[model samples]
Target: MSVETDKIEIAFEQLVDIQNTIDTVLKVPKNPGHIGVRDMLRIIIGPQTDSDQEKLSEISSNFLARRQFKALLKSQTLASQTKQAAASSKTTSGQVRRSGDDFDLNLIPSTGDDKLFYMQLKVKNHERFAQISKAEMLFVESKGVFSSVPLPEILDGVSQIMIRQGHPVLDAFHDPEAEFFIK
Candidate 1:
């Protein structure tokens, strides 16, 4: 998906640039029962363009066409993927049971560059989840020890797994060589 957005400060003689911006935005999705593209164009142009009706109409048509084209492309891609997945549906019993190991946090990489990390966790209760947010002890070599790191900092480090997968989590912000873990 490609989106081209351009903005300019309020000015005279460059009314066409504002029209072009409106023309390009007509490609936004339409659903959930809200305002139409024309109304949105009016909102963007009315206060800034001195109520120019002819320019508004031109901008509206261009933007609407672009939006429809993008929506059509997205719908086609989704339909193709759904069709492909439906055509492959075979499974083995042991293969399915062994898949549980994929979620094990202990299997995550724990070394290199101090930027890569991997961790997996299974939370059984809300209090456990809160404890994760309040992680104060370092889990290294299968033993827990009390530490002095703040709760928010610990949560931020744990959140990195969602952003980057297959990287070892490092402890440069805490102790450089200590291994950190969460349940």
Candidate 2:
């Protein structure tokens, strides 16, 4: 394999290792099914250098602060397109043509099967509101560790999937619940 490919494989392996470790931890019976965001972040980021830790905290905080409304807009655009297609066929049931209200955010973690962390954000008339687009929870696993990825990456991934699959995942990370930024 090429050098670049090898590097990618290594990175993927590391992620997998992390995921597996978390999975094992979650497997313990009677263990709390849910972990706090702080604990989860610590496990993923590790103990950074003072500055690095500070930066991670800042980044996390900033991510949590972003308004899901922006994400909603991107989602709505596609919803509109689907509406157009449905309009042509006189089938309004398959697509949503009207925009919806701002996002209704919900943070949920797994219980028995702790391999997926779900964040469900819903916008009530998704097409007409145009200003808001609902972002559903997306289950992503790296080596079996179940947790949400970063917000920017999640948004980008959702946007791409919406273009490809007609909608995004059912759960994903959006603006988190915190006040910090990565420096």
Best by TM-score: 2
Across residues 1-183, which tens digit of lDDT does each residue of candidate 2 receive? 699999999999999999999999888577332334554444333443334333323333444322232233233232221111111111233222211133333333344353443443344443433433332222222121222223323241222222112112222122122111110
Q: TM-scores of all models?
A: 0.19, 0.21
Please count the clashing residue pairs in each candidate, in the order shown. 7, 25
lDDT of model 2 at position 32 = 34
* Candidate 2 regions with alpha-carbon error over 4 angstroms: 1-101, 111-116, 125-128, 134-183
- Residue-level lDDT for 77 in candidate 1: 21
Error of 1 at 169 (Å): 9.6
Tens digits of per-residue lDDT for model 1, 1-183: 122223332343379787888888976776533435565343332333333333333333455533442343233221111111112222342111101111112223335555443433332234345544443322221012211111123443243232133212222112223323332
Which ranges in model 1 have alpha carbons more than 4 Å from their true place? Answer: 1-117, 142-183
lDDT of each: 0.31, 0.33
